[model samples]
Target: MCVAAVSTVQPVLAQTASPAASADKVDQLIKLLDDPEIRALLNKQTAAPAAEADTSMSATEFSALGHRIRDHLRKIGEAIPQVSSEFMRAGGTIADDINGHGPLGVFGLFLTMVLIGLGAEWLFHRIASRSRMHAALAQTDGARQNPLHSAGRHLFAVLAPLVAFSLASLGLFMAMTWPPLLDAIMLPLLLGVIACRFVIRIARLVLIGPRTGKDVAATAGLVPIDRASAVFWYKRIFWFACVFFAGWALVGVMVALSIEPGVRATVGYALGLGMLLVAIETVWNRPAAIARPHGRGAMEWALTFYLCLLWGLWVAGLVIILWLGIYALILPGLLKATTAMARNAFGGTPDVPGSGNPVVEVLVERGARAIIITLAVLWLAFLINKRSSMFTGEAMTDRIIQGVLAGAIILLVADILWQIAKAVINRTLEHAQVSTADSAHAARNGRLLTLLPILRTMLAIVIALIAVMMVLSGLGVQVAPLIAGAGIFGVAIGFGSQTLVKDVISGVFYMMDDAFRVGEYIQSGSYKGTVESFSIRSVKLRHHRGPVFTVPFGTLGAIENMSRDWVIDKFTISVGYDTDINKVRKMVKGVGAALLEDEELGPLIIETLKMKGVEQFGDYGIDLSFAMMTKPGYQTTIRRRAYMMIREAFTQNGVVFASPTVQVAGGDSSSAAAAASTVKTAMDLKKLAESGEGA
Candidate 1:
């Protein structure tokens, strides 16, 4: 019985420990179980009732996880009503405290506030209309003549309403003696009105600017238009949107004061539905109503897309309308602020180069905009979920927010690093340029500049790739598979393009070896030119005759750098055989000395010209060879100057230059003398004839 129990236990343990057992392990277990003595003992001990085994543990755990999620969602759904009831209770208490006698008393208070707000707006507008500053700002005349005039206008537009609201609030506090509770309830209404007006003012200031004919150019402005009609309609639509928002603010206050939270949300949803219908009606009546009369194609497309979706879809329509409200009424101010912040971060103002540092500036501005937009989107999502519960539930909402925040952080970090890298590169390039200007190291500095671009490009690509990976991971995507797939793809590419790989490798090695730098004249194979730039696998060479050559590193062999540290120039000049060799040598040396003393050539000349005496007796004259050393790229200029000076010096001293002459001397002296005498007699006879004609 004991042996049977042991055999049974060992098999059960082996099965549990290695369910997908290897062949060897399976054989070993079988052999143990099948031992003749053990098998006989087991059969005798009976089928001592096999113990029941439990399975399906993994399935059970999975079912439990699903149940937990469902229960959590149900709990969240159940608590939402309780939250709404609390808000309703709060609203009722506030109404009871404010209504002195009944709803009529509260109505009268609201009417009075509306009248005060309107009255102040009218009075302020009238006063501002009389000022020359406002007049100049409104007319769009002489705006470019004085930039401050336009700025003053934008400032007044933003500041005037704020000041008016402040005064109205003060008067409300001083003129009436309301209960503290009433003040608290009504104070929020006043604050909301102020905020609405402030938004309208800023939006107007940003979207509308001093007119440039039909166009507008501002620090924060929209694209320019070519027609006055388009501008006029754009302003009308913008103002209409602003007015709508202001009225909506008043309605929001009314809802807060009198309506329960559930009823308020229901009314908002119904209003959204009604607005969708109205939008459809407006577009149907006039297809071009949303489109600008003479706007760019992009603008027209944007407008068309907006209108089509605004009225075509159900849930998306409402959300788009809400986003449109934010864009027209809120985003302009944010954009203005972004521009100011970007400029200020670089200092109060940017220098020419810094301002032109579009990479860093654009990155900073866009990063800031992305952060603000992300926050805005999160807020909008929360609000939408609160009213509609359309976003699955709170768990999903939390996950979405978490993912967005994580992605934002990754992008911001990437943008910041990109900007820093660019700034460092720009600063380094500036220092190099200043240090190497008009010096022998200029070519080297140019090469360094060429490397900077490649470095910046690589850095940007790396940062962007990392940011993308982190964003994907934050969104719960599996990145390991993507990385593995990318590795395989890279290997495939390497195998397919062997020549490309060879070129890139050779180019990199060439750069590391410092064979030649940018801006240097070099010759390799049959191509010779000045180095214009470098690419990943080749160099751009600009020829002297205005052609650009792109030579791959793999094709280059035996490079000859013409513009290195120094260059030696050699040339020959022929003089008459009768010319004194010592005199000619002295004259050539004097010319070299004079060139060395020249202000421009003095620093370039490392060694003055030296005559190597007569090289050989040529057919016409004795050839004199001379050599000189000068700075690279300056040798040609120095040589030309030396030739000119030597010719001038020899000419002034009556030293004659060599001329081609032929004399027949192979025959006897008598034949040569007879030929010479014949030529002399013919010349004498011609002279005698001319003299006789003169007499």
Candidate 2:
């Protein structure tokens, strides 16, 4: 019985196993083989070949970029009808909202919010009207008073109403419930409106300034641009803001409507073209006073081409290249314009010495620069995030983009710090400028002047090095190794260039010791001159005789500072032996008194010139020692004047300067007379020869 049953089961199984059943068995077997280990093994086997295929495909795509661009353009052209439909649909949505099918439709709700906001803004404006008027009036006298204060007041006055409007509008919008579609569209629109209005108001304040009276000429704007330029820019900027905000709102609406990405890109390109045209128009037709001169039309054409290239890059979705071009073309001009505007607003005339507040000027300038750079960095980050896959090798592109953004931020921060440091150092130097008027703090001022420049240079180098290192780290470089290598290299260099190290070290010590300062006369070995300036390793010495020497600090040993405190000058004057000592002393005293009474020389003299008895007996006569103490650098002049006065006094008082005398004894009178005559003739001949030689 068991044998018969087995035989029957085998036949039945064979009959059931048809082709479809076999195929099902094979699929089950494949599923059983699909384990993680087996899949990983298969991937490993095909990885190299897949990578090669991807590389080839990337190369092909790169080679056919123009074709792709053309195809994209064709797609954009074909989607024009769809784009129009989408825009019409968006308009219809707004229209439907305005038709009041529901309570407080989008349009009515927006209108109510705007009206409330405007009313709030109006109330705020009325409340602050007196302050605003005062700020406006302050503009006329801004240059005479504190310009920063005036600018701040005006800024506050202008911003108050806008703040009130923003708060009211945002509060109302948030408080009301909105449909998802209308919510998305209305929020961006409202925000864009508020932002646009704020931008326009602030731009107007900066460019057109406050206007209290009817005459536009009375406007004292922060920037020194002429009224025509102000008006032109104000109008152009207004239009630009309108277009920008409108495009922003449109993009949001299209996004809410689920428009095709290609159509959206096309619309964006169109808006960009509009912007480009506006820029071109502004560039070409700018006021002559503010416009760059294009005498040969080269600059204008170049600018136009550059702008078009930027647009093309944008169209091609080459975000990196587009941003690089923008930064290259725009950053320097923006920085310069911002700085100039800040200086003109908060500072006095740029060319005038000590005219402006350095702190305020640098703060405003660097703050503006920081804002611009931050905005640019943020925009670039957004572009990278949005178009990360626009380039091949997405990982590398992301890293590069991140590095660039970080580097830009690092540079901006470093620049702000450097500018602030530079401003402080410069201001200190300006205050430390040596004055001709004698003051107790002259030495301290000179020392400050001498050391601050080197400190500033060193500080700049340190900031630059640190910023570069941070940027390298951001770029994914092994900064630890680089830093170690730099340290080693610096050590090697220091060892190799011992003289430079010595000079630098000596200079530092010299500054610390305050041995010599700028404008002080010092003598070291054979080098004697007035300190003109200082460098890291050397001091510039300007000689009294009009030669400049750059002497290494290491070479300057045992410095002799001649222009410190007071200088006592002494000289010997021989007088006739027959002169009365008492009378001569009295005459010298009179001369000293007269010198002290003189207007020009009186202040220079610390102690009047005095005759210090007989210094010694000379062959000609007795040598009287004359000494005077006077301020440094004026001692020589006073000594010269004293010599002249003494000579005049001696001549007037019949006190003759001594001369050589010879007496002939035990000789005939005629012989003696002849001898004297011969001596006199010889002396006269010698004097003539000496005069001739002098000439």
Instruction: Specify the highest-lDDT model's number.
Output: 2
Candidate 1 lDDT over 1-695, as tens digits, reads 99999998998898889857589998998998989998988886764443311254334555754565466445545555665575566557666676534445655776677677667866887776657455657667643333344456656756675777557764665578886656655665566566656665555454454233333443333222234433453455455444545445535654555544444444444455554444444444333553546534564456456655543332222453456564664577566667664544432234354334445566666666777766776666555655443333356566665676578767867777787788778777776665443655776686786688778778989999999999988877889999999999999999999889999999888887778877788999889999888878898889989999999988987789988778999999988989998988888889988998999988889999989877999977999899998888888988888889999999988788887654767878888888788877877998999999999
TM-score result, candidate 2: 0.83
Instruction: Write down the lDDT of every candidate, Cα atoms only.
Output: 0.67, 0.84
List the lowest-lDDT window of 10 residues for candidate 1. Answer: 218-227
lDDT of 2 by residue, 642-680 (tens): 889889988999998999887898769998989899999
TM per prediction: 0.60, 0.83
Off by over 4 Å in 1: 1-188, 204-245, 257-360, 380-444, 488-502, 545-547, 554-558, 593-612, 616-620, 657-661, 665-695
Which regions of candidate 2 deviate over 4 angstroms?
Answer: 1-47, 50-61, 64-71, 87-116, 130-145, 167-170, 271-273, 289-296, 348-356, 394-396, 434-439, 662-695
TM-score of 1: 0.60
lDDT value for candidate 1?
0.67
lDDT of 2: 0.84
